[model samples]
Target: MATGDEIWEALADFTEQCNNNKRLRKMQRDWTKILHFKAIDMDDSFTMKVVEGEIVKNDKGTVGTPDIIVETDSETMCDMFWGDINPTQKYLRGEIKVKGTQEDVMRIDVITAVIWPEV
Candidate 1:
């Protein structure tokens, strides 16, 4: 099993690569809703999809999948991940480099901000 840090690293890499993937970019650009999201913090990884406001596990991919439905404690979690920091800007400023959509990048920042209002 992968450690939490390892899982996080992989997710970051995976999303980054997925964002830059020409095919994925083209596909996501035409769609508005995400099918699912899987992510990992440390000890746990999960997958879940939104179905009429209920989150369910339909499939599995990476160990630390980005499913917000299964692992998250609340519905608001969908917007929670991005606000922690302006990771994209940080990356450009030599703080952190991410590998996902600009939308994904901004969402993470939004999550950060919501979670840590003091920061």
Candidate 2:
């Protein structure tokens, strides 16, 4: 199994490369208009970046952070990163949870579709 840092690096590299893609670029630009919520597990700290918005810090000592927590439900993004694993299942299986506005959740769904397009 890949280590946490390895996965984050891969994702970061992929997103950086995607920045060069027209479609992805357009979507990223669009996303800037909306607030983004990113839950990053930084080895020893769990940092949340609100992208172009506000990011409130979490007190939890990070280490096992998720790649990104889309407030909304995006099976595609989940499947892409976590193949065959449904968010609902994870939730039911006591894995992931969210604490944000409903709008944040809804917007995240759209963002997920854009970020994790089937390549």
Candidate 3:
């Protein structure tokens, strides 16, 4: 299992990469979303806020109701951010679980696909 700090670092790096990608930023333009991630293996939770086209805030604890909630093990979460794992496949195989509307879920998928294509 990955440590909480490692997961945080991966998310920070991933967010920076996404912010630097103009295409990806445009793809998510006007989107304001709050995302909650639960790393079951590490017993850690994080909340991220995406406003306009950038991830503006990421904190160690859940702050409020999220538009999307993602549940997975810490290592898998780290791997996903590192572009070493395919979120779609993991979701299909029950390795990752998500709770959100279809559109919101697809939005998350789109972000992942645009920033970190399957490998």
Candidate 4:
């Protein structure tokens, strides 16, 4: 079981990584969104926002109206951020659950591919 701090750190790092990528920023330039992450294993939630192609993380809570909500175990989330595992695979296997419009979800997939491409 990953600790809450570990999960938060991983998520922070993940967002930072995405924000630092020129390709990612260019791709997400027009896609402003608020995302909510629910760590089922830790029973905690956090928020992240993408605006003007930059990622801004907010503390746990209903910071704003969410465009997408993701639910997954804390360990799985950590692994995904640390590049130890692929989120797309987990989602395909039903391990990670996401609630969002098809377009929104596809945007995330595209972002993930840019950062953590198949390896």
Note the clash tally of each candidate: 26, 1, 0, 0
lDDT of each: 0.38, 0.39, 0.90, 0.84
Over the stretch 72-112, how does candidate 3's per-residue lDDT look in tens digits? Answer: 99999998887788899999999999999998888888888
User: Which 10 consecutive residues of model 1 have the lowest summed lDDT?
Assistant: 67-76
Worst 10 residues of 2 by lDDT: 52-61
Which RMSD does model 4 reach against the true structure?
A: 1.3
Candidates sorted by lDDT, best first: 3, 4, 2, 1
Most TM-score-accurate candidate: 3
TM-score of 2: 0.41
For model 1, residues 6-89, the per-residue Cα lDDT tens digits are: 444544544444444454444344333233433333334333332332222323343333422223322212222323333334
What TM-score goes with each of the models? 0.31, 0.41, 0.95, 0.92
lDDT per residue, candidate 4, 43-92, as tens digits?
Answer: 78888888977886657655788999988988987787777787788989
- The weakest ten consecutive residues by lDDT in model 4 span 56-65
Residue pairs with colliding backbones in model 2 are 71-105
* lDDT of model 3 at position 43: 74
Pairs with backbone N, CA or C atoms under 3 Å apart (clashes), candidate 3:
none
Q: Comparing 1 and 3 by lDDT, which wins?
A: 3
Q: How close is candidate 3 to the true structure, as a TM-score?
A: 0.95
